[model samples]
Target: MKELSKRTAGFTDSVIRRMTRISNKYGAVNLSQGFPDFDPPKEILSRLAEVTKEDFHQYSITWGAQNFREALAAKQSHFMGRKIDPDSEIVVTCGSTEAMMAAMMSVTNPGDKVIVFSPFYENYGADTILSGAEPIYVPLIPPEFSFDTDALEAAFRQNPKAIILCNPSNPCGKVFTYDELKIIADLAEKYDTFVITDEVYEHIVYEPFKHVYFAGLPNMWERTISCSSLSKTYSVTGWRLGYVIAPPVIIDTVKKVHDFLTVGAAAPLQEAAVTGLNFGDDYYANLQKKYSEKRKLFLDGLDTLDIPHTVPQGAYYILLDISEFGYDSDLEFCEVLARDVGVGAVPGSSFFKEPENRYVRVHFAKKNETLNEALNRLADMRKKIAVKK
Candidate 1:
């Protein structure tokens, strides 16, 4: 048999997912993955039931169903503080996964360089590899998880084809401030680069840390390929509904890449999720309120247990410091955590591109009871760990 392609030689199965499997084997509360353990909105569920019975069982347009795009455009325009053209700017995709992949394929040429933040979502590295582009890593220094302007500018000076921005970030849960976005926008303009954003957690931001759309920045629309999803926003990961909103010139290419990639997001799912896109600001406000409560409950539990953890400003994830646990390998630590402690976490090393082995990620997008259970398990951990040390 012929040898397989060399491009994927460095690839491994997702560490986050591997931890989930370990959680299953150990029967631990699985918090490794970022998915919610609850149902989507009631309105969306009702619409899904209707779509299931209706003629939407058939495929819609290859890009998206027209009404879905229009609804999405209207909703996004209202929030983004700009007019978005439904026909020219939108491409519904299989997920933010596919949306980001399509955006990479749409712009990156082989041998090009793309700037990526360290401790990024795992898929960004793989996306660059798949697109045959080199990744230039910039560190988001820990504690506050703030970026160095000089370091970022240095990466931009490398003349990268694009930069992947995951605002309301994963693992560390850092939301980029407007000043930070402005610096990046200025650098993108200076270097003539594209900005491929994964803003899936846009609506899940906590108080005092707002989410600002990269495309909405002054003079950025033409170069920003904004990728987002209804998955986190609506608690419907299985539906795989995501989209790219960009300038007509860039989106034209994205539409083609997305067309051949998955041929569009699910037809019935898209039709159903239109209900969520049409949700007013009050719905989003309540979403923040709900997630904020989860964050408080989980963090308060950790504090009571005297565990060290990063306080997240946005998104549903928390990074707990494990340096004092005396574990050298985050991978082994996570497995031990799952098997012995009865709580699952993704190794922080899996997300960080740097030599990081001192932390692990856990999420709280679960019901109150589930969060309580995970916290209970975690409280048991402190007892076992303190005795060992």
Candidate 2:
């Protein structure tokens, strides 16, 4: 038989998902994946129940359901500081996963180059490969997770087709400030590059740190493809409701790609999530408050245990420094940690283009009880997880 697609031949199962499985096998507290352990908003859930009895079972429009798109546009426009036309600027996808894939497919041709910041979410690498694009990884310097303007400009000099920007970045949790974003905007304008953003954690930002929409930048709307989802915001990862927001010409192409990708996001789920999109500012304020509490509770526990970790400015993830544990491979250390320390984490190596092994990514998007349980188990970290012999 012919070999499988070479594009995927080197692919391994997702490190994050693999760590979740290890957590399960050992009954460890699973903080490896970024999903919330708590329930989604009751309002959305209630609407979902009612929708089951309604006529939303059949597929909605291929681009998106009309009401869902309108709701999303209104909600996003209020925050993005632009009036988004739902009809011309949206393509509903199977979550940010498909939104990103569709965006890449729409903008890039084979052998095109895309700028990706290193220590990014692992999926960006796969997305570029699958889209037949080469990735130019610019490192997001650790400890501060800031980028050098010179390095970024050099990447842009490569005449890349696009850049993948994760605002409240995963693994490192760096929120791109307005100044940083402006630098990116300048480079993108200078090089005529598209910016594909993953802004899933937009609403989960902490105090003093704000999420600025990339598309809101001066003259950026035409060159920006904003990909986001209700997964992180509404705690509905399984619902798979995400969208690409861009100018009509770009979105026209994305709609065609999306139509051929997953048909459309689940119709009933889209209808139900509309309730969440219509939620008031107070709902978002309360959501930020809840995540702030979780971040404090979890990070304070790490401090109490004397574990060195990066304090996230926006997202729910914290990168725990494990260098003192004397592990050469972060992956093996994560496996041993799940087996012995009763906690699960994604090896930091998976998210970096560099050979980094000093940290592991863990999330705090859980119920208070679950976070407490994980903390309790983590208290015995040194006693259980030992250095390599």
CA lDDT of every candidate: 0.92, 0.94
In the range 315-368, model 2's lDDT, one tens digit per residue, is 899999999989989999999999998999999999999989999999999999
| Candidate 1 residue pairs in backbone clash | none
Q: Supply the TM-score for candidate 1.
A: 0.98
Query: TM-scores, in order shown?
Result: 0.98, 0.99
In model 1, the runs with Cα more than 4 Å from the true position are 385-389
> On residues 1-389, what C-alpha lDDT tens digit does candidate 1 reach at each position?
99998899999999988988999999999999989889999999999888878898777999899999999999999988999999999999999999999999999999999999998999999999999999999999989999999999999999999999999898789999999999999999999999999899999888788999999899999899999989999999988998999989988999899988887678999889889889999999999999999999999999998989999988889999988878878898888899998999999999888899889999999999999999888887856554224
| Residue 258, candidate 1: C-alpha displacement in angstroms | 0.8
Highest TM-score scorer: 2
Runs with alpha carbons beyond 4 Å of true place in candidate 2 = none
